[model samples]
Structures are given as C-alpha cells and as structure tokens.
Target: MPRRSYDHYCAVSRALDVVGDRWSLLVVRELCSGPRRYSDLFADLPGISTDMLAARLKDLERDGILTRRKVGPRAGTAVYELTADGAALRPVLDSLSTWGTSQLGERRATDAVRAHWFALPLGRAIAQRIPAGTATVHIGDSAFHYVITEAGITHHDGPAATPDLELRFDLSTATEVATGVRSLADAIERTAPQVSAP
Candidate 1:
C-alpha cells in the first residue's frame, strides 16, 4: 500500500505525514530507550497487536526514522534502532511529555507501566539539576540506566556498569516527577526514594 498524506506542503504537516499514525510516536518512544529486538518491542508495548507492530515498524523504516540491524558476532538476532533523523524527535517527545503531564491524574486498571518509559523524564530532570554523570534508576523489579552529558541524555533498559548515582522510586513517584506534579527534589523529599552517589 502507498503511504498516506494530506498532500499538503507545510513542514508540520509533512512531519505529521511521517509520524501521525496512532502508534508511530509510541514506537519511536520505545526505540528511544535503546535498540530492541522485535520480540522485545512487542512485549514492552502492551496493547499493540502483532500485525500493527509489524506495520508500524515497516513504516518507520521506510520513512528513514529507524533501521533494522543485525546484532552480535553470530548475527543470530536483529534489533530496531533510530536513525539520526528519528533521534531528533527526542525534543518533540520531551515537549509532549511535559505537556501531557497535566492530564496524568491516575493510572486506571487499563494502564500499563514500564520503568524504562521514565528514562527520558528522569534524564531531563537530572540533566537540568546536576552536572554530567550516569544514574541507574531502580523502579521496582525493573531498572534502567542513563548517561547525562552536555549534549543530552539517553538511556537503555538495564543497570549501568558503574553508575555515578543510584535512584529508587515507585511508579507513583515517577509519575509525579515525570508529569511536573512534583519536582525531582520534592519527590525525593516526599518519598525519600533512595539516592546514592558513588
């Protein structure tokens, strides 16, 4: 099938033509954490049907937003990762994350949570307040690590080798911090989620 578009020439419309699908940006959000195997993506994304996931992945690839790559010396598996053009969407996602914060009142029974989903919010919060370093965030059984530098922050799903700091927070606390309901320091003070320095 051919790609759909409004046939409009405006830049915003053009960008949306590439990313306007229901799950397109979420797929980008998943990739933002790190390269992920096909199954990895399918698993993390709770409600996306297998077919829809496949379609979105293909669309993202065709649009040059992400690429499929072989991993390991054996080439036994493949993973999806963002291209530079795709990675540039981080600021956009961040803005959305910030904007959407207000609407997050509570997680209903239907809501799904993934610890690594908080990576960007945590990265942004830490980056603003602290100097360059790494932090391994422990959110319950799940954990992820992120690197902070002058350029920006990026994360992967798992613990870091030797994170300069370690932070532990529950999902609610994370939500509060992520949504701007609570500042990072305030969240730390309220919940007193463990924060340790190397």
Candidate 2:
C-alpha cells in the first residue's frame, strides 16, 4: 500500500510522510536507548496493539529508519535497531521533548509511566550541571545512567557498572526535573535527592 502524503515539495512534509504515523516516533524513542527485541518494544508501548506495532516496525524498516538483525551467542535472537538515519532523529526527539515539557501539566490516573522515559529530559538537565561524566540515576525501583562527554549526552537503560556519581531520587522529583518544573541542582540542595561521588 502506498503512504499518504501532502505531495508538497517540502523537507518537513517529506519527513512527516515517513514518521507521522501514530506510534512511529514513540517506537523510535524506545530504540533510542539501544536495540530491542520485538517483545520489549511491545511491552514498553502500553496502548499499541500487536498488529499496529508490527505494521509500524515494517514501515520504519521499509523507510530505512531501522533494521532487524540476529544477535546473541547463537544468533538465534532478533532485535530491531535504528539505522544511521534513524539515530539522526535524536535531536528531533530532544527538540520535541523540550517543547512538550510545559504541556505536561499533571499526571493523570490513566497515564502510564516508565522510569527510562525520564532519561532524555533528565540527561539534558544533568548535562547543564555535570557537563561531563558518568552518572547512574536511581528513580524508585528503576535505574538508568547518562554518559556525558565533550560531544554530547547519551542515556542507557541500566546503571553504569562504575559511575563517577550516583544519584537517588523518587519518581516525583524525577518527573519535576524532566518537566523542567524543578532544577536538578535545586533537588540536590533541597535534599529531596541524594547525590554522591562514588
């Protein structure tokens, strides 16, 4: 089936033609951490149906945004990873995240939350302070880490094996930090979060 398009000769329109579908960008967000099995993607995306998820994956793959490959000891496992083109969307995601922060007024009863979902915004906040280093952040029962360098910041799904700094905070504080309502420095100063060098 052919994709619907604005048929305009505009870069933004072309880009949207590829990723404007529902769940596409969110799928890209999940893969931003790293490659993930189909099951992992399905689990993280709360409301998407299995058929919809498969269709989106196929579309993204067809568009050269991602690729599925076999990995593991015997190469029996398959995982989906972003291609170079897909990884290029990181900045786009960052921009959208920044713009959407003020729109996140309050958590609703029906809203689903994930700890790693805070990684990007918190990473941006942390980079302003630390600038460069490995920091493992613990938000409630979930753990994620950020690696900041002269180049840029990249976040991962799990804790660093040896982090230069360790931060512990509750989900509320994390949400505040991610949404830009509270600064990480303020959170540290207020002692709502415990930060230490390890």
Candidate 3:
C-alpha cells in the first residue's frame, strides 16, 4: 500500500508524511531508549495490535528512520534500532514532551503507566543540576538511566553499570518532576526523593 501525504512541499508536512501515523511516533519513543526486539516493543505498547506494530515498523524502516538487524548467536533474534536520522528526532520528542506537560494533570484510571516513559522529560528536567554525569533512576520496579553531556541527554532502558548518582522516586513524585509540576531541585531539597552517590 502507498503512504498518504498532505502532498504539501513544506518541511513539517514532509516530516509528518513519514511519521504522522497514530502509533509511529510512540514507536519511535520506545526505540529512543535503545534497541528492542519485536516482543519488547509489543509488551511496552499496551494497546496496539500486533499487526499495527508490524506495519509501523515496516513503514519506519522504509522511510530510513530505523533499521532492523539480526543479533546474537546464529543470528536468531532481531532487534530494531534507530538510524541516525531517527535518533535526530530526540529533540523533537523533547519539545513535544515539554509542550504536553500541561496536559498531564493527573494519572487517570484508564492510563497505562511505565516508568521509563518519564525518562525523556525527567532527563530534561534534571539536565541543569546534574549537567554531565550518568544517573540511574529507579521508579518502582522499572529503571532507566540518562547520560548527560555537552551535546545533550540520551536515555537508555535498564540501569547503568556504574552510575555516578542513583535516584529513587515513587511514581507520583517522578511524574510531578517529569511534568514540570515539581522541580527536581525542589524534590531533592524537600527530601521527597532518595538520592545517593554511587
């Protein structure tokens, strides 16, 4: 099947033409952390059907946004990772996360929550204070780490092998910090989060 487009020559429209599908950007968001197997992607994305995930992955690959590669012994397993072009969408996702902060008033009963989902926004919120170090944040059972540098921040799923700092937060506090309702610095000062050097 052919892709539908606004057919406008504008840059935004062109970008949208590639990634404007319902679950495309969210797929990108999941991959932003690191390479993931198809099962990993499906498990994390709560409501998407298997067919839809497969279709989106194919579309993203065709557009040069990501690449699917075989890894491990006998090349039995495949993982999907972002191409450089797709990784460049980090700042774009950051901008949207910032913009959407206002809409995150409270977690609803129907909302699906994943701790790593807060990684990007929390990275942005804490970048200034912990300007150039790796931190592994634990929010309940889920863990993710961020590497901050002069270039920018990049987050990855799971814990860092040797994080300079470790932060532990309850989901509520983490959400508040990520959504800008509460400042990380304030959270630290108030002892709402447990922070340690490791």
Candidate 4:
C-alpha cells in the first residue's frame, strides 16, 4: 500500500507525517526501550494484527524511524531498532505519557498489562528522584529495568544485571506509581514494599 501523508508544509504536519497513524507512535514507544524482535513487538502491543504490525514496521523503516537487523551471537534473528532520529522521539513519548496518565484510571476487560508497559511513566517518575542510574522494577512474575542517563531513559524487558536500586511491588502499586497517584516512596512507607540498593 502507498504511504499516507498530511501533504502540507507546516512543521507539525511534517513531523506528524512521519509518526501520525493509529499504531505508529506506539510502535515508537515499544522501540523506546531499545531494539526489539518482531515477535516481541507483536506480543507486547496486544490487539495489533500481524499484517498491521508488518506494514507499520515497513513504513517506519522506510521513513528512517527504525531499522531491521539480524541480531544474536549465532542463529541470528531479525530485530527492529530505532534510529537516531527515532530515538529523538523520546521527549515526545515522555510528553504523551505524562498527558496520557490521567486517562489511565482503570483497566478494561480487554486491556493488557505488562510490567514494562509502565516503563515510560515509571522511568519519568524515577528520573525525578534519582536523575541517573539503573532501576530494576520487579512486579510479580514479570519484571523490567530502565537506565536513566543525561540524554534520556531507555528500558529493558527484564532486571538490570547490576541495578543501582531495585523496587519490588505488586501490580496495583505499580499502577499507582505510574499514574502519579502514589509515589514509590509513599508506597514503600505504607506497604513496606521491598526496596534494595546495591
């Protein structure tokens, strides 16, 4: 299929021309963490059809937003990763995440939840206090870690090998922190949540 565009000269329109689509920014969101295998992106997105994912990826790759590469020590597989231009979308994601927090009041019957899904908000929240370093968030059977640097934040699917700090909490508490309703400190004080430093 041919690509769609705003077909205008305005700056905002030009920016949107690259990222404006139903699942486009979200795909950028997934890649914000780092490189992801095609299967991983499909799985985490939830509800996105395979064809839709493929097409969006193609568009993104064509636009210089992301690149497809063969990864692994051996028996390599394909992974999609953000380009420098794509990584530049970090602030955009952060802004959107902050704005979207208010709308995240409740999870619907069809809503999907994953620890890493809250990475953006939590990473922002963590950045406020720590500013820099790595944090591993362990929630139930799942986990995610993020490294905050001078540039911006990038998350990983699982725990950091040597995290500066670790936060272990359940799902509800994770939601509370992510939504800005309750802070990690407040949650720790109230529930005696596990917080470790190494």
Candidate 1 residue runs with Cα over 4 Å from true position:
72-76, 189-193
Q: Which of 1 and 4 is ahead in TM-score? A: 4
How do the candidates rank by lDDT, highest first? 3, 2, 4, 1
lDDT of 4 at 21: 83
The lDDT values for all models are 0.86, 0.90, 0.91, 0.87
Against the correct fold, how does model 1 do in TM-score?
0.90
Cα lDDT of candidate 4 equals 0.87
Best by TM-score: 3
Residues 36-130, model 3: lDDT tens digits: 99999999999999999999999999999999999998999999999999999999999999888888887899999898889888998768778
Q: Could you give candidate 4's per-residue lDDT for residues 1-198 as a string of tens digits?
A: 777778898999999988998899999989987789999999889999999999999999999999999978884899999999998998898889889999877889888887777888888888887889999888888888988899778888789999988888888998999997898789767666478776
Q: Model 1: per-residue lDDT, tens digit, 1-198?
A: 899998998999999999999899999999987899999999989999999999999999999999999989999899999999999998899888777766767778889988777777788887776668888888888888888888878887788888887788998788778877789888667755477776
For every candidate in turn, the CA RMSD to the true structure comes to: 2.0, 1.7, 1.6, 1.9
Candidate 1 local accuracy as lDDT?
0.86
Of the pair 2 and 3, which is ahead by TM-score?
Answer: 3
> How would the candidate models be sorted by TM-score, starting from the highest?
3, 2, 4, 1
Candidate 2 clash pair list:
none
Minimal lDDT window, size 10, model 1: 189-198
The residue ranges of model 4 lying beyond 4 angstroms of the native Cα positions read 72-76, 191-193
Better of 1 and 4 by lDDT: 4
